[model samples]
Target chain A: MESQNIKKKSVRKAGLLSLIPGLGQMYNGQQLKGFAFLAVTIAFLIELVTIGIPAFQDFVTLGTVPIRDHSLFLLVKGTLQIIITFVFLMVLILNVSDARQVAKQYNTLGYVNRSARSMLKNIWENGFPYLLTIPAYFVMLFVIVFPVLVTLLMAFTNYDFYHIPPAKLIDWVGLQNFVNMFFLSAYRSTFVSVLGWTIIWTLLATTGQITLGILTAVITNQKFIIGKKFFRIIFLLPWAIPAFVTIMSFSNMFNDSIGAINQQVLGLLNYIPFVHVSDIPWKTDPFWTKTALIMIQTWLGFPYIFVMVTGVLQSIPDDLYEAANIDGANAIQKFTKITLPMILFATAPVFITQYTFNFNNFSIIYLFNSGGPGDVGGGAGSTDILISWIYKLTTGTSPQYALASAVTIVISIIVIGVSLLTFKKTHAFSNEEMM
Target chain B: MRGILSSTKFNRFFSRFLTYLFLIVLSIIIIYPLLITVQSAFNASDLTAFTLDLHMHWTLANFQQLFTQTLYLTWFKNTMIIAVSTMIIQVIIVTLAGYTYSRYRFKGRKNGLIFFLVIQMVPTMAALTAYFVLGLIINGLDQYWFLTMVYVGGGIPMNTWLMKGYFDTIPRDLDESARIDGAGHLRILWQINLPLAMPMIAVQALWAFMGPFGDYLLSAFLLRSPENMTVAVGLQQFIADPTNQRVAMFAAGSFLISIPIVILFFLLQRNFQSGLTAGGTKG
Candidate 1:
């Protein structure tokens, strides 16, 4: 009973000490952890005072002195500082909570006498996971997360052609870029058409590939099928080749006059009386361009789904099909009831991601035709999806960084929303994690 | 009854023949361009035409020109540097992180995984200016290491999840028993886990190595100098101007790059099957 008072007192004392960032661990006799935590917190504070606060100020104002202070630099630096601070605060919280928890553990289990060597051993053994992952998080914090934040923040700024930094400063113009994309007269057509095509492309191209893949898998996996290995190799060829090469080749092949598609293959069709149109204008005509893009994508993408479905197909129990046959079910019935659902169930995540992939399939669109076949008046071409258009805006001589960022955020929202939906639907894929 | 039996036999034969025929036609569609590429690279006559001709006018000139007239060697070296760096870093980080997520049920493991998922879904190309700005800040603009890190960063989240999934299929009893034997965590991972996870690691390594070969959008955005350009970006310049496209040379370059990768893909077929089922791309 009396020992309870002492235990409670230690817990409260540890909690109080932890408010100073590392004192609690020292009190708990985790001397190294205590010192490391204190060191990190101090280092963080040093960085925060020296650069973080100033960067925050810069982020807020963008730039006060145009020639001297580059707003773009300030924006990037400030976003990095904010990310660093967030990481620091998270560590600080962990430190404090860790102190309280360790104190409680000692009270319950009874404190063991600690030596310096034992303390180091304990750290190596206990902190192994953190040791492994910290380096990765540190790398990701700058490389992936930093850029994302800058793009997201840039959406609310006017960092376009005229307002570029060093020569001129960009200021916050919240949602004006999006407003112009939707409500304004000039951009509305391009924006709507590009978005509509993006949706159409994602649905048609991804589904078309998956459907073709499934069909090929079913045919090739037939019990009596010969040379299965050879067919698999051949089908895998499209995916095995680098995508840019294939896209580049397809782009060359789709040329109206020089390309074999027009000069040879379509020429044979032109000899037919009703189909006597000499040229299809595969590049110059937007409709044919879109059609060619979809066909090329279907060709490029089908092999992956084929490989995936083939794996799933082989794994399906033969007994289920036998049972269906016994029930006097036809081939289509057995497929619809068993094969299709099983493959779809196994590959649902791939389908979602493939949609995301084709939605932003920049290489296929850009390398194929540079998203051309339309006037550049509205900052996009006839074949331009939002992602390709964003690329053009970001890469052009006078890049519209603000507008591109706005589009990126929109893509992010759609992609993230779909991924999140998949996540929820899959129930976080617990993966036997509870074990 | 005998007539019906013969009819059924005939029907079976017809269906089997149709299946074979359909497969053959599809194979032709996919393989014809590849055949054209090979033919053009050797044909000597063709410069820009994607010909379907079977006639031979073969020469080693296109490959010879690619190495001499262009910066193809330099581009190949640049691509190898980036791909190899990204692959090495990706393998190390992914295996380490995979071990942690699989073996340890530490604080925020679930949350961190989900956070990474959300972050991973954001397309790498979406942050174009930020990448430019980041390259500038790090003095990495046009630098191979910069592009390598971006590749590592872009691929890490998905690769880590895939690795973890692979690791999960590995039994925990081995590790638990190793822990009882007083083996250190690193020792356990090195001796038992890594040896067991070799297949997944191979898949991961191969995918990472191939990424730089096809990447144009980001490489183009970050790299400015001709000396630093990767093969994908370098080869495109051959065909960039409509009037000056050297299609034969482009074919030669792609032929060299694609054939070896295709061979590797075939060799790693089973490893790839499992890896994709666990949700990693061919990459």
Candidate 2:
């Protein structure tokens, strides 16, 4: 027992030994793990040095010469910087991983020489989940993290038209961009109006869908409802189709001159003959645009609600309704007392997600209107949500990367705040049903 | 024990009739556009004008023209390449990741899950700038492999959790038995857990396949060459470009695009529903 104890180090010494890559493993007596980390570090440094030298040389040769044309210097430098950083991070993570593995082994076995065959078998059994996760981590880093970092950095810089790559150098502008967005009246108004519309759009779309969805679920779940299964399937169909397809089809449907809804169906079923179909301003009028967006959103969104509510509805046992019936509860009374509560309880977290989802429901607005009538040349639309507005802000005239980043920061704050709130309210949001 | 209406001794058949009438109207409201589009795909005349007039000059000429004129076949080929490649890579990655999270007690298991969750909340659009830059840096953005990489990355988080959830549902005793039988981790996962989690695998693959198909924005922004465009982007270009503003072509093209997904949905709907139900019910 004393000899076994001699093989393991205290946790404090093990932690302190992690200052150098894989040293913790060496401290924990894991010679192989420590060696592997050392090799990886050396290899990464070698690779970085190899790629970086030429890049530095290119940058020096092209130093401060404003050519107004493309050069390989910026590309090379950027590539080198990314590679160095990435390699650096990979090493750090790998070292930490090695240390953690050593610590785990030390906890159990008191030494790292713990038979390679058993270790291999254990890894073979448990390695799949780790293997699966690594790609996702890389992807999440590249796609989500890298871009977000770039955007955040761009917020502090003047990376606009003049600073376009291969041209004049753009320096850091501090919080000036954010100041301009907030303090400048023109920017503020546009931001406010666009934000207002986005809020309205999210509310109307989500509320409309949820209300109608619940109502439909209730009706369909009722006893003696013929073809209930058929209705449920039909209701779920809209959601099954791609959002782009639905929006594109609906956009065509609502067209005033050439639209099927305006011309053939509405014309044929004309309860009011005086209002000509050709004169309808479904896409043009601001009121109609907002209405059209809401209506289209409802069509796209209701099916999700229908599907969720169906799940929630089924979870409400038959005995509850029977109990309600015995208590002299009418249909509406039964719904209020039993059904709505059960559905709401089960679906509140989903409902919060619905709110956040519609907050960025870009496909509908972009595909439907392109946030249009051009906002009467104001560069936004009556139906433009915050996400589409941010998109336009980035891609539109003058290329407001700084302003867009500020907008993103604000959006991040709101989203995080809402997420925390929702998580607090529903344990499911936090617990997340881990497999 | 009985029908509410029948037991009332007062036949409120009018309300039932009205409800049916309302539902029928609503169903038509939902279904009419699809019906119109299907009809227009067959109509010989140009449907670009978006006319309400149901001029039923029925012909398969639009479908015939689509085959003759466009690179529908090329687009189909490219889409299949992207979708299939993405599915293969994504399934392997997600399945492994899911198994790890389910079975292993790693240091950052909670943190990793949180990271994925927070990352998922960020819009895909947020990554466009970095993605474009990364592609340029690596010289990979324009290639088929690059798109597949992006697809795998994009699918990893949600799909991993989903698979993890499935793996969680699997009894650990299976693993114990496999281990006692001298099966390795990979062997157990491949031989036992994978087959048990086939529904999730199908769902993951289906989602991965559908991703590259439905995406227009990413493919459009990233893939510079016309040859690289997926069907969604290509078809949209067909509608938007004046020379190819053939609306009937769009319909026909959409019909073609819809085929795989429709088939996918029907074939996997039962499994998909059961997976979803299991996910919801377990939580």
Candidate 3:
């Protein structure tokens, strides 16, 4: 498809010209795009020079007398500025490459230099994807990326309650918070125990949901079952309701003095053999609270699994089961060999995500009991998982920002690590062939 | 052996009975909390009402008090505004992004996809410190718009992935033909791909709407004033405060809020199932 007649423009020269942000695009006859890129990059640079540099310098030199007291603010602002600048630099590079590629395309097409209007038309046709995605990028940059960067930066500074910004400067402590959390303080024990509970909760909640879900799905899928639609809708109630509403309602229902569970449900249980109860103290008692939380999670989680497994169950070919039956395989054998493996294989990635979700299941812990029935001298509660513990550390009376940030980093690592490992194993990220 | 099995017909009856029993019991367990919430909302009690005493006086006092004595209406209004706005914004952004990612073979596309996947792993609360700092800078604390922005932003990564997956299933020949007909990219996306992917889009919109409707922590953090608070945060105050144990009123409020959502869920149950399973069993 290479054209022999057109004079080819040097891609390298075009790329070099893009150091001015739009020059290369202009050379490639993409005036509007080049100008747009140039304008945005220049505006970003201008902001960086006038405001970002001063803040960054203050961060580096620890500031002079007037601004010295605002070190934390300056540091955070400067770091954010640097991140934005880096983003623009990447954009600049992208601009250069894009320009070079367009020029080469033109050369191949036998078009020496397209007219300005046709160039605009080309952009409107081919550049639509980039144009459409700009808003998404803006949202991601400001909302997710910027905040995450600030949190990461905050981990290195002593920006806790004692170092309230603008009132007292928060200095860079250089892994001191991590040291304190791991080795130097009581927080070490809390972190360890919370991590332990987090894992335990994730395992129990996830497995319980999957087990109950599969059981229900198997039963509901039975031809013997009547009123299948009614049962399905009823079963989905727990999942259909907003989780926070149900969680909070459960919290009240588990109240020892006035709660329905203690007042009516357990009161009836007292009549059963070997069962005696004054009250269960469902939320206040550490053991019961954790157990109740697990049960509640199971109730909340199983329906989704039920729905998924049901879908998988329906999709499973009847011929396999028919073959097993022909071979004289019993119902239990067919289930164990056929249904179980197929469902697990199909939904393994979902199950892993469910595990990860339960690991960070903050609302259930926080909303139910505020991570309460306090344990270990108010640093955390009995039900406090890692995410809830982080919440408490950040929002509690002492507001330990650095410690919280460190914990956040730890949680991110565990979550990301598990997700990556599981995604690889399950081939969750593999591409589906287009139909 | 055949005669012996044929003689034990009662065993088959018992097994079928057990299955039904198990299902019925589990359904009750699942629906019990909802029943209690509904009952409590109508029960005329100033405090926690646990008894099954259906003969007790039923009144609309709790609902009346919920409307008149609290900022319930304001909170409801605020939540509706946020949920609707977030839904619209998130749908638009993710639709465009998803279409772009699906149809385009641009530079950095692979890295961009990986970036989104990695970003999804980072929980939003992990970046609370940054959001707090940002709120202070933008003078956005206590504002619904800022909270809306956060919700829309937070929903994009996962929703975009979902939408892109849905888009992939729609044959590209449609877009090719549209281009042949001289339709532009936007027209093809809006007219061709979108109509086919309507189920997934509806699912995304529902989730986006429900996210802010149910979110407690972020709303509580970003919005401080009572009037500005969303329903989730506002309802929690009834039970959260030590001095004010308003369980019945909270129940009433919860019931009221749940009606529309439950109706929506039932109406779109099929779409919900297909969307979730498709998104789940696929990428």
Candidate 4:
């Protein structure tokens, strides 16, 4: 108790000391934490100086060889090193601020400097959550954050096939890729058309899913329907099957020459009045391919909605319907008034997510027909959404990495903007307050 | 009165008839491709094309070929290693993250949440080049472990959100008492909240399993060796060759992969549905 009367440390002093990376924590009597921070920051700096600096130097020199030699490797290495340094700097700042806050608490509370053991105990108590989450953050930093940063920076560079690193150095050409995409005649037309189709596909596919799902759920929910569980499990099969497998299987079945639909089903339909069914060119012709993609997506997507809507439907209180019944509302009226709004209200965020998902539903398009019909030109096929187009641009015969990066940025902007807008309307963020 | 009753009865009958008719048609459309897949898997012909021939003989040769002629068993082994490892690690990381986000009030929490949401908007495929570069930097270019890390990292944001939402529902009072009784944060999370959040954890685990299992593009990009390929990538290779389009074998492979997944979904159907709707609406 007598030690509690000792003079408290100033937060500003502590902050200034922490500029040396843990000196402040030591001054504030947290030796172990201070030493740990000091050790980590010093190691980080050491690595940057030893490895990062040389890579960056190599990048600046554009390799020892002539510019004709590929130096994309050095550029990538340097860029990654720089990004890592930036993250470390952020961590350093956070550490300093945290030390300052703790020191300030000590000052205000008149908490006397505790022994090293007690300080460690303090960390164990208060820092446990951070400790638990650090591994996740570390993994995410490398896997998600780092890659995203690289992609963003890669957009500014010319890393296309022509500049394949090791033989040719990629130069930082800011906004040239964007200009090429939006202004250049050859690229712009393909960009516009692909974007248009992407939007159309998203809208049509989502609406189809929602319509089919709601209808299925409503019918299944009817008291007259028998074996409801059986119907549901059957419907769930499409979603239950791995989507890639299904898409590939569908691709095979839609094959023009020997496909089941063409050779068997359409062959049967050939006998129908006024129908002349032949090989439908399901994956080849542009028009038919797009149509097939939409249909398959709808099939793949609707089961999820059906499952989600069924859950929502179950939660809808029966009293509302009873009240509506008292008002003499018919089945259609009840559906439109009570069921629809409630489901929409509960599922608005998911609806937006569904749209965004379909917008970037790359695997289905890539696997189903490889975004084919190949006639759209400029490495984009008729069914190529922004995602698949980006994929093709990077992996195509003449890889346009810069253009792909630009497209990625564009797609990110669209998705984030739209999601934010819809999220606001749905009050998803507001729910965080309740927690 | 008699006439009116009869009319109402007729209307009810008609509506029920229409419902059945609609359901039956939708079921056919949905189930037809799967039926064809089954048929193709059994069809003995080397040609993978769908035939209308009713007399086509069923045989086990396609499955036999999948096991012997291709590296199907090796692919399964690789896929299981990746998926299982990813699922276990992901469950741990996501559980901790979700609990942190749910139970703690700290500086930068809101910013962290926003960061997750915004970051998730960027498609993982958008970073293909970066992934390759990352693979090189870590010296894990062709390793299944690297792919597992990617899958785990990719799943974190959504699973974290889901777990957080679930944790929010658990009564804080339960943990409050534990805290008063000298339990630390980790203890409370482990002893009090974990059991309650098992459903969400299970849901996250299932999804993590499926992520690596269903992925084609990433596996194709990361793993170049035929023996290292996952089922999805390996099967695609079977049909990808123009000259050797082993469609029947591919069908057999696809059928084989889907069996366990479909069975798992069935086992976890109720939990999966609740988990999805709960995350979508409440989280």
- For every candidate, how close is chain A to the native chain A in TM-score? 0.93, 0.82, 0.91, 0.90
Off by over 4 Å in 3: A1-6, A17-45, A61-69, A112-114, A273-278, A433-435
DockQ category of candidate 4:
medium
Put the candidates in DockQ order, highest first. Answer: 4, 3, 1, 2
CA lDDT of each prediction against the hidden true structure: 0.85, 0.71, 0.83, 0.84
lDDT of 1 by residue, A19-64 (tens): 8988988898888788889999899889889888899999899989
Residue B25 of model 3: what lDDT? 95
Off by over 4 Å in 1: A1-9, A29-35, A112-116, A268-278, A426-435, B278-283
Task: Residues B56-109, candidate 3: write the lDDT tens digits.
Answer: 679999999999999999999999999999999999999899888888887667
In model 4, the runs with Cα more than 4 Å from the true position are A1-5, A31-70, A270-279, B51-54
DockQ of each candidate relative to the true complex: 0.59, 0.43, 0.62, 0.68
lDDT of 4 at A307: 86
Q: lDDT tens digits, residues A1-435, model 3?
A: 347666788898899999899999888877777888889988987898898888788777444453345765676678777887798888888898888888887777755335667767776877787898899989988898888887887888888898776767777789998898788658888888888888999999889998999999998999878899999999988877888999999998888787888887888888899978788778778888889999999999998899889989988999999999999998899999999999987777678878888888888999999887869543899889988888788888899988898888888988999899888988876754332
lDDT of 1 by residue, B87-107 (tens): 899889988987788789877
- RMSD to the true structure for each prediction, in A, is 2.4, 4.2, 2.5, 2.5
RMSD (Cα, Å) of candidate 4? 2.5
Flag clash pairs in model 4. A69-A167, A70-A166, A70-A167, A70-A168
**Location of the lowest summed lDDT over 10 successive residues in candidate 1 chain B:** B274-283
Judged by lDDT against the true structure, how good is candidate 3? Answer: 0.83
Candidate 2: list runs displaced more than 4 Å: A1-18, A22-29, A43-111, A114-128, A272-279, A376-378, A393-398, A430-435, B1-12, B50-55, B171-173, B176-183, B241-245, B280-283
